[model samples]
Target: MPLPNTSIAHALDLADARHWTRQPPKRPATRLRHLLRQTTPSALALRLFAYPHTLTRWAEGDLDGLTPAQATLIEREIYRTWQPEVRRRAHQQILDHGGCVTAQLHARFAYTTRSGEFHDPRLLNVIEDLPALHARHLFDARHRDAADDELRRILADGIGEAYFFCALPPDQQQAALTISDLHLIHFHY
Candidate 1:
């Protein structure tokens, strides 16, 4: 497939990541404690655009019954829920491990359905929706396969709005509109 349209993507090379570190976490437990700790929010949010989260994984799987609009919302919730994870790992990599990763994929999508008008992929977490999602997830899961499909689609097709917000970088690094012939939208990793 075509490389993910560059708009929703962010690239942090070893060089770019080098300056973003702190001392590596001494224990995995402590590492887990650092997420959403304020210092790491903005940076991690930026990094999220590139790292492949649950939503990305879904796109890569069978999307026979999914849609971009559904993908869009599911992506948002999944994206929001991942904040803590993203922060902690960022610490491990940049802070603890010298930011040794070869790169980060934030939310770069590689494929998407060519159908719907783009959905807004920007995260509007309301900051307190984590618990709400957790509560609803069980209920949603009972309805369909996509039950767990996306927080963004039931919920991330449930994600993009690129104006997927993530798919469209402010830099215009590349254009965001990568209309495709497929149904499920997949981001670059």
Candidate 2:
């Protein structure tokens, strides 16, 4: 696959250094700092280190502010870490789209929880978005013997969909299955 026509310099030019500098440090920023220190050239790494908050902001999805070279280096590092088949496909997609593919992949798989930890995308539809009312009903009936004080707590802690389904009465289980099917379709679609 052919690389995108967009030059590294141009991509770097798209970043807004000022905006990144003003943001506070967060997990993404911290992770990006770590990646830079571990993978980037020492001088470039030092330059980014001087603006820790800004680096964090960039890691959190702010493309602006990074130099073209810096962006290229980061992208390369990310690509290098992927499994061979995944890397090949991602490279093809990036070439086909004429830009970065990691961002799209990251967005697809990344689901932030209420507590700020990344949630599994597979569990997102059934658990994360299960309505509080429905969850409460499930807990009251299906999970009656369980010690948890609240349905929300159980869901947040990561209950399996199969367990929840099996606990439901036959009719409710069917209903739950239907609801889950619809949710899965919607999520994948």
Candidate 3:
């Protein structure tokens, strides 16, 4: 889909007419930031019906910020229009303390599994395949140097090597250990 051609006044008028009570036009940047925060590049692609590259450029610090009016429209029409169950599951993924607890509960409440017979209502629902989402992220990182650099930067600055190491899969963990050892021997000797 083509990007919506919307002026600030037009978007404000749309919001006002649609009964959005927030006085957003006066503080436009805040509204834009809020929408940007809600959406990831992939999520934005899904919402905007745009290619991932368009959103990727924005995410990679290549594009300028979105207009407040455009942001407001996206938040209202795309993000808010997301199904409630999807939203709740996403919330639970972040808010739930332990994955084990949520996994068990989800298995009990929303799914049944047997040998070659796993059943899940959420499978038919949007936002259910978190495992697949996670796997896609892993695949992306493995294939993309930019993603690897981003992951390394995140580990170095935010999460620390230990946390990042712990988060890696067993095979990757072994590889990381070998690389660390090589670096240590090269520098420390």
Candidate 4:
């Protein structure tokens, strides 16, 4: 009930209350005072002033006036912390489209995870490994070197559209859904 003494915890509580309860205190320090007023002063003091240690930094003016870069850094940190969630969303996207199909591979290749953490289907133990699912493509060891060569060429050429697709083997290219399929509209002609 009492807001945690930590800044991260306090921010999270504020964000949750703002988003879910639609009740955010008008002033930044109001929650601190409200918590202290409701809870035992000694308990509040112990938690707020003693254990976390950052309170002293705030009191000493060390944590004031955060720069935009600092705020961005914190946001990025929080985003990075949600890698599991990102992976879950990506994995779901893959599964919902028909597992391991050529269309699914194309969709996945074009996908971008917001958190920027790499999700190896194999690492997540998804139903199929990238290579296995694309077996018709790169699983053939004979073509691995050629595939790697193609991938390097595509990357070196600096083509944005081909970045992900270029990484695949010939078989994968053959199996992939065309860009037209990916952007198809259901409008009546």
User: Between prediction 1 and prediction 4, which has the larger TM-score?
Assistant: 4
Q: Model 2 lDDT vs. the true structure?
A: 0.35
lDDT of each residue in 72-111, candidate 2, tens digit only: 5554433333233443343344335543211000111232
lDDT of each: 0.32, 0.35, 0.33, 0.31
Per the 3 Å backbone cut-off, how many clashing residue pairs does candidate 3 have?
Answer: 0
Specify the poorest-scoring 10-residue window by lDDT in model 2: 180-189
TM-score of 2: 0.21
Tens digits of per-residue lDDT, candidate 1, 1-189, equal 434422211111112233333443333223223433433434533533423343233334534444444444343323333343443454344433332222212332333333434544542322111222322332243223232234233222222331234545456433333322222222211
Pairs clashing in candidate 4?
A: none
Q: Residue 119 error for model 3, in Å?
A: 42
Per-prediction TM-score, please? 0.21, 0.21, 0.21, 0.24
lDDT of 4 by residue, 1-189 (tens): 432222322222222232232332333234333443445545544634332234333334455654444333333323222233333444344445654311111111223333343322321111222322232232122123233344322221222223344566665443222121111111000
Candidates 3 and 4 compared: the better one by lDDT is 3
Clashes of each: 62, 6, 0, 0
In candidate 2, stretches whose alpha carbon ends up further than 4 angstroms from where it belongs are 1-50, 84-189
lDDT of 1 at 44: 38
User: RMSD, each candidate, Å?
Assistant: 18.3, 18.6, 18.6, 17.3
